[model samples]
Target: MAFSVLTINPGSTSTKLARFEGEGCVWQDVLRHTAEELAPFGTVSEQLDFRLGLVRSALAAHDGGAVRLDAVVGRGGIIDPLPGGTYRVDPVLVDRLRLGRPWDHPSNLGGVLAFSLADPLGIPAFIVDPVCVDEMAPEAKVTGLPELPKPSLLHALNVKAMVRRAAHDLGKTWNELNCVVVHLGGGVSVVAHRGGRAVDVNSANEWGPFSLDRAGGLPVGEFVRLCFSGRYSEGDIRRKLTSGGGLRAYIGTNDMLEVNRRIQAGDDEAAFYCRAMIWQIAKEVGAQAVSVGGPIDAVILTGGIAHDAGFVRLLLERVQWIAPCLVYPGEDELLALAQGALRVLRGEEPAQDYASSVLRQ
Candidate 1:
């Protein structure tokens, strides 16, 4: 019998959960908690507990619904940088995740939630293709020696989903295509999927290019000046770079939908920013395509911004010359995580002993 699996992804402001029964996606749910409401937690752990309660209540309400689920998979958390594989997360993994010492994104905490809930119920849990997709080349790792840089390929889940769905729709296997995948969300990331695997990506950490929230890779002297401003600490600068930096910083709102609404209503400022953001995406995506030597099968755009018709049209017009473009506007992380766990549960996939969690190409 095909296994039943539940997957969870906790974003900064929302918790996304889904269940997959066999090859079909049975059901999915997303529950959001506003950051303002969660401010009292002071730290991530307290916030995690508060959100876990909300999820527990949601699961309880759904317990009587359509079908019984067999296993639960939270977003994978910190497990030394190992190769891509699914494992039944044990106590060791849970301890490491709770500490959030080495790696701690809210998404990583999904693995913790999955482990806590799955183990007690005697079900299996796993984090599939975590940020630890670190197969970085030696050069990618060394950031002037002092930093020993390790930045996550955040949004790999959605990017991979784009690759999978695009391949499925294009009548080609993923391994047959070399594509540049762009995930435009509250923040953004562009990845180079080479030889059917995501060889390199830039999202939260290091600089890529200018983004909605991030300064991207800025000039050293100006960047140093900006960070040295007495008004902001390192964490403050990072928050701006990660969350507060993007469109919100520019226009005071992160809602692309609202921005587009303004554009339609004849707000020239909104239209200008929209063009600028897409242009940035187009420029970076084109560069990634160039890195792969100009043979791009499709420029795949996924995530919330990808759902915007005006933005997609703008981006396509700008970058379509690279190749045809495809839009996979939905995120399929729950399905992706569930499938990985089901493979482990059914004995069809082996739990790879990932040597280096970060696959630095």
Candidate 2:
């Protein structure tokens, strides 16, 4: 039987809704929220009812109460670190999301919203590989400072999805291959996939290559001096490093298309910065290759920036010798969410229990 599933991915200003039957997406919509609309909510978690109403309305209009959903899957949020897989949205998980542990993010609404819609129907609600999926090897987590260990927060949803796709293309199962998968979007994640496990990865938000908006790795001594300078607040420095750095800091914009246009128009500085970012990405790929060890079956380039042929070509020139380079441009996170639920619903993989998963940690 083809399981029908509803997938919800909540971003900062939009809620992406999609319904899938088996492997195919029946329809999809992005419910964009304006600043004024979200202004009333004191916190992201408080906007649950507001976002839920929008999703409910969208589903009503699209499905017209005709389709019976087998399951509902949501984009996982920033919760405790757990391994990668589809997790059942139980009370424990919902409580964590509602509490917004660590910090509050718009994504925290995904699971709660999914549960709201699925609970009445007596169907299962699931959250796919969230940002907190930590599968780093113990040795990989260590740093010179024992207190400041590395984190395994990457684009796991897309990374795992692309890994499965790459495995299929290579006529191998996901567990049968060792690959280095690079997700190049707003942040860059260079991950070493040994068999099916993400043994090591640079936390996109904190390390790895400088991306469209993130600073990536910075000189430790200089960063410390800047922090002690007291010219900027903690929040200011964090925003600058994560949202105001990289190509935007160098070229005044984060849009790669704009950078490409400027380069074509004979902007040497733009071209130089672009090349530098690509070089950093290639270098990170080499570092991850060492983490994977042995022979890497393939090197996959994915996410939005992979659509840039010139950029991919430059990156390939540097890393292609390591293995055959494959480009899967753009991320389909909604589909990835649905596929996670389908894998469990179809008995291909067991659905992880959020409470037990956390306890095991």
Candidate 3:
């Protein structure tokens, strides 16, 4: 029997949801939250019930008319470092997300939202390849300074999904291939997947390439100086590093389409900055190839930014020598989530326990 599942992927201002029967998506749509609708919630966790209400209303409007869901899955968020797989949601996981300490991301609500629906219905809920899926080799975690070790936060769901897709296209299993998967979206994360394990990755939340909005990796001494400069508060510095930095910092806007338009319309400075971002991304890909050790099988680019032909062409020019460059534009996180639950339902993979030995501090 095919299992019906609800997949939830929450973003800052929008929730991407889909209803799937096994691997087939029956219904899908994005639920956008207006600023006024989200203003009351001071914290992302606080918006839980409000977001859940919206998800339910969307499902209710489905043409199937109150579809019976056997399971629910969501995009994972900041929790303790764990292996990449499907995890069964329990109070331990829900409590961790509610506390919101490990890291606060909109995706954190994914697990919360899944549980809210699955609990009373007496069905299983799962989170797949969460952002905190840490498979880093010990050397990758060393940051030279003992106090600041690198964190393995990446778009694991999409990256892994695309990697497997690419492997299938190449007539090989994902475990038999080695590739560098780059996820370029609002935040960018490049990961080295060796033998189906993500041995190392740059966290988009902390640092990597300066993406459309994120500052990425910053000069430490100058960053520290700026933090102590007293011209900004903690929130201001955090906002600057996260939401207000990168291309937005250089050109006063984060929309790459607008930047590309200006460049086409004879804006030299805009062209320069956009090219610079692509250069930085290429440099990051090269760095990860080193981490994975030489002779990358293929360099795959997947995510929203990969859709830009000009950007991809420039990036390929820089990194194509290292390996074949393939583009799998856009993310399939909603399907990735549902498939995680489907694997367990089909007994293809076992659902891991949240409080098991797999967790590492």
Candidate 4:
């Protein structure tokens, strides 16, 4: 029998749900929430019940009408650093995500929504290649300062999926190729995938280029002054770093389409900032290219921003010298989540437990 899988992906302002049968996508829907709709919640974790309600409603409204599901897979959350694999949603994993330690983001809700539905049906629930997938080499973690080390947080799910897809297109497997995949969305992540393992990646929150809605790396002196300026609280400053900064800080909006429209309407400043964003991304791709020793098989671009031809052209002009630039626009995370579950169901890959020595502190 073909395995039935439901994939749940929670974003900053939307809940994306997909149903897949075997290797094909059966149905998909996105439940978008406005800022006003989410304002009542104290944090992302607080929206669990509210979001779960929408997930159930969306599944019920499917044409099949609440058919039995063999498994449920959610985008992974901010848990302990673990290697890339499909993980069963166990109590320990859920408990940690419930009380976010390092920090909280939208992905934290993945485990909550998955278990709520899968537990009632007595089927497996899993999360694959979470943002915290730590496969950093020992040297990658060492920073010039002894007190600080770089964290391995990137778009693991989308990057891994694209690498595998690119490999398949070339009639090879992901394990046999090396590539640098850049994910450009609300945030930007440039990852160096050596063979099948992501040995190094910049935490989307801290390193890399300023994205549509994220501040990315900032000048140390000015950032520190802002933090102590007392004009903003800790939470307010963090929000500024992630949501209020970036293009929004300059242009007052995160929507690239709007920026494109402005550029068309003779907004020279908007055109300049957008081009700057592309330039920063090209530098990030170049940095990761060096991280992967030897020749780069490809420099792959995959995310919402990749769809912008003008931006892609600008980036290509800068970094195409490093390697052949490959554009696989749009994130395929839902399909990737479904396939991760299918791997375990087909006995092609074993589902990893939440606890492991490498992940332990």
Q: Which 10-residue window of candidate 3 scores lowest in summed lDDT?
A: 59-68
**Candidate 3 local lDDT, residue 230:** 90
lDDT of 4 by residue, 64-160 (tens): 4548799999999887888998999978778877886677778888977898889988999999889888887888889788789787888889988
Could you tell which candidate, 3 or 4, scores higher by TM-score?
Answer: 3
- Residue-level lDDT for 142 in candidate 1: 56
Q: How do the residues 27-73 of candidate 1 rate in per-residue lDDT, one tens digit apiece?
A: 66889888687788765556677777877777776765445667777
State the C-alpha lDDT per candidate.
Answer: 0.71, 0.92, 0.88, 0.87
Better-scoring candidate (lDDT), 2 or 4: 2
Give me the overall lDDT of model 2: 0.92
Clash pairs, model 2 backbone: none
RMSD of each: 3.3, 1.0, 1.7, 2.2
Structural similarity to truth (TM-score) of each candidate: 0.85, 0.98, 0.94, 0.92
Residue lDDT tens for model 3, 1-361: 6789999999999999998887898889999999999999988999998999988888888844457889989888888888898999999999887777666779899999999999999999899998888889889999999998888888899988988888988888887779999998999999999988899888886788898888999999999999999999999998998899988999999998998999999999989988888888889889999988856789999999899999899889999998988899998888888877888999988999888835555
The best candidate by TM-score is: 2
By lDDT, the best candidate is 2
Error of 4 at 142 (Å): 1.7
- Give a tens-digit lDDT track for model 2, residues 76-96: 999988999999998888999
